[model samples]
Target: MAKHHYKVGQTVSGITKGYTSEGLGILYTEDNSRFFVKGLIDGEEAEAKITYVGQRSSYAKLTKLITKSDKRIQPKCPVSTACGGCQFQHIAYDEQLKIKRGIVENAFRTIAKSDHPVDECVASPMPYYYRNKMQIPLGLDKKGNIISGFYRARTHIIIPTPECVIENERSNGIIATIRALMKSMRIPPYDEDKRSGVIRHILIRTSYYTPGLMVVLITNADNFYSRNNFVKALTKAHPEITTVVQNVNKRKTSVILGKRFRTLYGPGFIEDDILGIRFKISPQSFFQINPLQTENLYKIAIEKAEINNSHTVLDAYCGIGTISLIAARHAKKVIGVEINSRAIRDARSNANRNNIDNVEFYTADASDFMENEAKLGSKYDVVIMDPPRKGSDEKFLNAVLTLEPKKVVYVSCNPGTLARDITLLNKKYEIKSITPVDMFSQTYHVETVVLIERK
Candidate 1:
């Protein structure tokens, strides 16, 4: 084994490995040195390069495919590897589901060391057109053409996206219109260094529960020449566009949109009905992108909790009260708590617009609220937590355990953290059901809902 450079021709009989947070891992080599490999799959053998030397493990790169895994497939996107948006697009959807489910299982078994049985993977119903929202970045390509797409995987550089196959047809149409309008107006693109441009990005969202479309233009300033022109063309081209708004992100940052906004067209909001409940989405509020699937997800949570008119429910991390509103119809009282003040305002307004009198909104950190509730000996018959990708923290999880609710519905985007947190609560709670819903298709992300009963 030479130390300076590795011959790409050299072959190593090693199994392709799985990954955790950092990167893929290989089985320990002879002499007990772990090899950290990249651009390879689990249960595969390939010729690799010793890219870098490390204390505990050596980093290697795949040069030749020695053995191919059954899970591998040709990625659909030409720039899949370069673009960071979709992680498992190369793998077949079925294979991707298997790998994701295994990750969830291992997180519980190996990391958390729990005895709960991880169920089979539940795949997405519609792999394409599952995305109702898309935020297209605006920049200039190498050819000096204005580009609008997602950022390349892990870089600040933008990848101009002309066509996105995974989003709804209307979204793709809007993107095309934006591109054509830019070409027509010849609006100069935003320069990251100089911080000057007419447009920054375009956020397109559609509602499965409503017939209307929402288009929000995120720009650096209120330069209304091209934006006004674009809006005219967009609404004229697509009658589905019921609401169009402009978001002013004057601050110097890569964030697409800011809080300050102005309505360009329609009533400042789009109405959507879910589970016999109506919701009005404001520009800044948070709502599930995949509306149809979210209906099922909320239905599952509401059904499993056995919510009744006599039960008092507390919904933590409730964005715009999507769940709390649905739960309100069945529960005696529902309190939706969130840290975003804007979201809280939207939640309250949504409840008011829907004429829901039982549901209330609270602006506070979720974990802090749970801890304080525990200290006050306050108990809720039902508690629903739909945390972000990180899942619930230890303080919140422990506080929830002490509350001893009749049923706890945990909705999570990241299964690894959900499994880990479930293991910690296994001492006081029994795993009743684990249902995985595919909110994001053509992507590796999964939305899992778990029900726990106090033992």
Candidate 2:
């Protein structure tokens, strides 16, 4: 490989041209070589020190800002730069929407090779303090005292934060109370290196539509000494806490939750309403973290689906039947499929609680279920899919193609993978409309809903 033009610790000055999908500012040198600078925005002239040199591009840290962009604003969180949670916190909210829309449009143009016009990104109702869920890792600081907060950018080092701007206010309080109690009780944080200690993580989930909260303590072992007192103290401190659970995760892994759960107080789950449908949310249920944005996203998705009483809908990768139960209200019948059986159980319970008789759920892989349905000559008028960040795979897209649904509404979190899947599906379906939703405000991640029609 050719020698890199920029060396580490060398200072370079340039005007930022654009922002990358990861929210880094891009600046080009005279030779057209690019450097991605963090904590910088587009159209800003800045001096930065090279942090790392790559084959094609270099990474830099912004040192001095000569000219700031009009969209640049002060971030609300004190540790926004180090927390790695919200990448676009410095940008104005309106500019954030524009950037996210550009991200979707660029993905389609570059990955899908389509020049389709994308709608403006729908902004979240609450830009900050919108997240209903929070998972804080427990670790020890240099003083060997208990520290509970988020990990730093791309590393396991904990950044102690008493409050996070994006998390629900109640969740923050819960975290603070837990940290205080852990300190009072002398509960040591789990040592990943030594593989000793007790608490590993603390997960808090707050209800958006109701006055309910679920606190899950993920520990390295099942034994939580003085567990009842812990629950009593937590509930006494925070009356909003409706449920408390202890998840035993003994494995030496990065995953937070475990297979076994023990409920110490109230029911094992909390209930929340989304689009007038009450959902029983357990610690492991895959509900959307941003409830308000989720409502808007689902509304747009259902509108684009154009479901009617005569329509039969297939909701693939349905998590707890959020989309399927919502679609069942308008469609004649809805079938929801997911790989996690626990979510399927919750879906069934949610449907029963809502008294929706037309929806059915299956515990199977989405693609596998679709392939079996195709073999059985199953038919449906509409298909709705809300895939994870990686988006749907080719096998899943092929299975969706085989079903020959008249309309397909794809909900995607990753624009690149969505564009790739759309390119493959475009061979059979015609792209109708694409709408991006700002589910995660102050972050680079954006959710998109696409409508496609049989060609």
Candidate 3:
């Protein structure tokens, strides 16, 4: 390997040209080499010290802002720089929308090689305090005291946070109560290195449209000493809590939840309303974290679907029938497929609870289900897919091409993968419109809804 052009601890100043995929501002040095700097906005001249020198690009920490951009603002959170939770907190909200739109447009142009237009990102109604769910890791601070907060960027070290601005406000009190209970009860935070200790993580979920909250205590062992007392204390302190669950995970893994769950209070689940439809969210269910933005995203997807009483819809990777049930109200029939059995069970129960008979759910891989459906000559007038951040694979795209749905609606979290998948499907479908939604306001993540029609 050759020596890097930029040396560690060296300071340089340049104008920020643009943002990288990870939301870091990109600056070009005099030698035309790139440096990725944190806490910067486009069109700003900044001085930064090189932290890490890589083969292609160097990483830097912003030392001083010589010329600040108009989009810069004072971050609300005190630990925004070190928390690594929100990347665009320093940038204005309106400018964040434009940056996200540019991200999507660049992905389409560079990855998909398509000149399709991407509209401005739809702003969230409530940017701060909009998150309905939080999974906080429990660990010991420097003094060996129990602490609860999110992990620092690219490290296991926990950044003690008594409050997070993006998460639901009610969660702060709940977490504080749980942390105090654990400390009083002498419950040790799980040590990943030793694979020992008691409490691992605390998962909290709240409802925006209903008065209910669910707490799941993830532990290293099934036995939680005086678990009943803990539950009672939580419920007494927070009357809004409707359910409490204890999940066990003995294996030394990074995954949060375990296979077995023991309900300590209520129905082991909490109910929430989305677009007037009730959904039972359990400890393991994959529901949207932001309810306000979810409603907006679903409305756009449903509108782009153009569902009618005469249409049949296929919802791929449908988690808990959130989208399928919503579409059933406007479509004749809807079939939802998911790989997780727990999600499928919740989906079935939700459909029945909503008294929706036009929708059915199956537990299977989305691509496999679509492939088998194509072989069976089953046709769907509309197809709706909300895939994971990795987006759809080639097999799924091939199956979609075979089905030849009149209209396809794609809900994507990662624009890069979305562009790649769209390119694969472009062989049979033509892009109509792409609308970006601000699902995660402060973070670099953005949700996009795209509509495509058969060519």
Model 3 vs. true fold: TM: 0.97
Per-candidate TM-scores read 0.88, 0.98, 0.97
Q: How well is each residue in 1-455 modelled by candidate 2, as lDDT tens digits?
A: 11365688998888788778777888765566678998787789888888888886678888999998999998898898899788988999999999899899989999989888999999899999999999999998898777888888888899999889999988888887887898888777799999998889999999999998999999988886777888899999999899999999999788888899999899989999999999999999999989998999999999999999999999999999999999999999999999999999999999999999999899998888888888888899999998888888877788778888999999999999899899999878999998999999999999999999999
- lDDT computed for candidate 1: 0.78
| Model 3 pairs whose backbones collide | none
Model 3 whole-model lDDT (C-alpha atoms): 0.91
TM-score of 2: 0.98
Indicate the residue-level lDDT of 328 in model 2.
96
lDDT of each: 0.78, 0.90, 0.91
lDDT of 1 by residue, 289-368 (tens): 77778787888889989999999999999988999999999999998999999889888888988899998899999999
Return the number of clashes found in candidate 3: 0
Off by over 4 Å in 1: 1-13, 19-41, 50-62, 423-427
Query: Pairs clashing in candidate 1?
Result: 16-44, 84-153
**Weakest 10 consecutive residues, lDDT, candidate 2?**
1-10
**Candidate 2, which segments miss by more than 4 Å at Cα?**
1-3
